[model samples]
Target: MSHHATPVPRHRAPAQPTTDYDVIIIGAGSAGLSAALALGRCLRRVLVCDGGPPRNAPSPGVQSFFTRDGIKPAELLRVGLAQLEPYETVEVRRAQVQRVKPAGRTFTVEAEGKSGRTFTATARKLLLATGVEDELPPVPGMRDLWGRGVLHCPYCHGWEVRNQPLAVYGQGKIVTGMALLVSRWAPDLVVCTDGPGHLSDNARRRLRQQKIKVNEEPISHLEGTAGGQLRNIVFQSGEKLARHALFVHPHQHQRSTLAEQLGCRLTSKGAVWINKHSQTSISGLYAAGDTTSGPQKALLAAAEGMEAAIAIHETLTREECPK
Candidate 1:
């Protein structure tokens, strides 16, 4: 691959003016930043718009990432930003994307800065890595202790609370599956259904085999320690079940509407649908990370971003240099 320089405009007065950037990546989390790095190294003019803190901002530390395990989420992003400074072709802006308008082969993106100033920039290709947002249960203290005592991925935080009294919150087959998965880390596990545990006979039998107890009492609220760790699950009848941590698979949705606005195909689970090459239904548009259906992890998201970059580069190369 050959590297060529493309002059980028320092500023544009028009609300929506085309830029020299070959790619415009929205959301500067792991996936977006990784793609920007790869594209920048290719000497492609790229603009990465960061939409503030990532979804993992509430988590105390990032887990399972190579050489960066247990590092704070914010710190991990800080390191990523520092490393991108050397890539002059990549410009990262602290702005939230508000709108995306596809014009033939290019896209015009409208964004609002921290100062509330709105500007627009256009690129030949656009990548959406805006991630997703988790919607927790309505029970009290759930939000307060989220990412601390309350978590979603056992692979990410299970070891931190291993061998401790744990609880999985949900009903039906989902909770049963989560309980079984969580049992790998701790022996003292229980399922809190908040009401009726709609489990099949086989599911109940499986739970009994694993020695995991089931609590079907309606929950009043969750109790947490001053340090933000979960202490107990309070039932409506005033009974409290001591627990150190809670695992849940909350419903999630895309953090940005750009994909929908651009009419990209979506999965039944509400994730942006992509082909093997990370291209969406739209020819010049792409998606990666939690924005698409699959296991959501920092390592996986970064790898997807790298793959999307390679695909985009190859496509661009084909278009610019005809055989």
Candidate 2:
């Protein structure tokens, strides 16, 4: 299977012919590829730099997509490529962006491939569709069951694990919101935090009314089977809580450093800051998807990407017109 990862070392490949383009997309994910398609449909020459490092590769299939719900991840990419194949002005390269710097009039990108290859390209405008990654708990046996039974998004995995024994694992302050919402999916839901979280009196009462147990012990380990399917959670107080699925509130980080490197302001939570119109602090730079400030989900990312593309089109059009 083809794979993508953040290149630890700068791997340089055989040099290829270099050229400029109307716009350069730094990722080929759901958002990045969608933006490239929209711009290309507008007759804008576009090139997408994606070493195929999609953040959702771990997902078995993409559900709740409205039109293409239940489509497998790799299948979705294949279909997207097929649709864009007729667009002669568009090109996709399997390269990961290492660094991006603005030149006198264009943006320069250095991308490294896993096969020890490096690529350089230029574009008039830059699109940051790089998504985010989840930060799991420090406890052992978590990564093995990460995407299988330990999930983060309720919209994605809620229905699958619905009505089962579920637990919400979070830090001192992160589990409350998820606990309240996940209660609807599973009747036997519990909130497990590092300690008795700073829950308001009202929240505490509401949780008790729902019969959801609240535990204050620090987590010892997220116990699970050998093949990555979660089973139970172990507590520091020598308690093993049987659970079928776990909802974790993972700390998130932006996948691409290019935005921060280009002076894109970040929210307190480290997500890229964008205006209501999806425009970032940087004039020509735009960000969307999970990288920006919002609830991270498949549909949300798609919508944000489209909205940002609209703002980008407007700005570039205004720039092209003589004031």
Candidate 3:
């Protein structure tokens, strides 16, 4: 695809444009925000629309995140907004993007909610930073207590819940592997599949060697304490097990329905496909963060965003320069 031409008067954009934008970014999370920051610095007349919902929202503190470790997710966004102010070239809007369509050399974007509006970006490029959503088991209290006691990412919440009695719930062998890794942090662990069978025999032996109990009991439901901390898990046979925390392997789904709607190719992992430069299949379009396949770390996403922003700068500049 041809590189996007820079938007005309790429300053702080007007309220709404009749033609198109120079660039419209569709997420405001770490990757999207980082990309916006770079573009704003380049003076690219950029607008970022984020629903403000990120996969990491459930956890109180983000660990292994370099200098910003142990900070609330919302607090990071606050800092991003403040830093972005210096550029005077980026505008961040809180909106849930519904759809995106490329027409000729421009694109039309429709966003929804009190945060909803329709506008055309006359500019030549697009960036998607929308993240993913985790699919948790149908336990009574799991979803409500997601980022709390019932956690998905071990690296993020493992240290906090380390050394505590933990319950590992999973379906098949995938859970078995996770149980082995989790046992490293918490010695006392219980591995169970609510249904008939998932883990194979060889997998079972490794789990047993590690002293992690593998139970094949059908789970009736989960029981939690007042603070939403996972307490005792109840099995179908009225059996109960004591646990302070429940670790799970979240089945994830891409939250960017807009990507599919826009014909962006999706990989097997459900992430938007991109080149090393973060450029997607459609020319002039780019993606970063969880939306792109690879690692799901916040720090990594930020780096990818910065890289994509640089590419955006080069591409736009090259396209706009007079021949």
**Top of the candidates by lDDT:** 1
- Candidate 3 residue 181 Cα shift, in angstroms, is 1.3
Native-referenced Cα lDDT, model 3: 0.82
Give lDDT tens digits, candidate 3, residues 1-323. 89998888645432433454578888888898899888988888888887866788777877788899898988887887789988777877777777777876667777764424554444578888888888988877788778887887788888999899997888677788789889989899988788775677898898889999877888877788666677778888999998888888888888878788778888987889999878999988899998888878888888988999999999877656634
lDDT of 2 by residue, 111-196 (tens): 88757688777876777888887888787777778777788878888888899999988744457778888988999998887665
| Candidate 3 off by > 4 Å | 1-20, 113-117
Residue-wise lDDT of candidate 1 within 221-245, one digit each (tens)? 9999877799999999999999999
Quote each prediction's TM-score. Answer: 0.94, 0.87, 0.90
Clashes of 1: 0
The clash tally of candidate 3 reads 8
| lDDT for 10 (candidate 3) | 44
Q: What is the C-alpha lDDT of each candidate?
A: 0.92, 0.79, 0.82
In candidate 3 the C-alpha lDDT for residue 114 amounts to: 49
- Model 1: runs farther than 4 Å from truth? 1-18
Q: How many backbone clashes does candidate 2 have?
A: 5
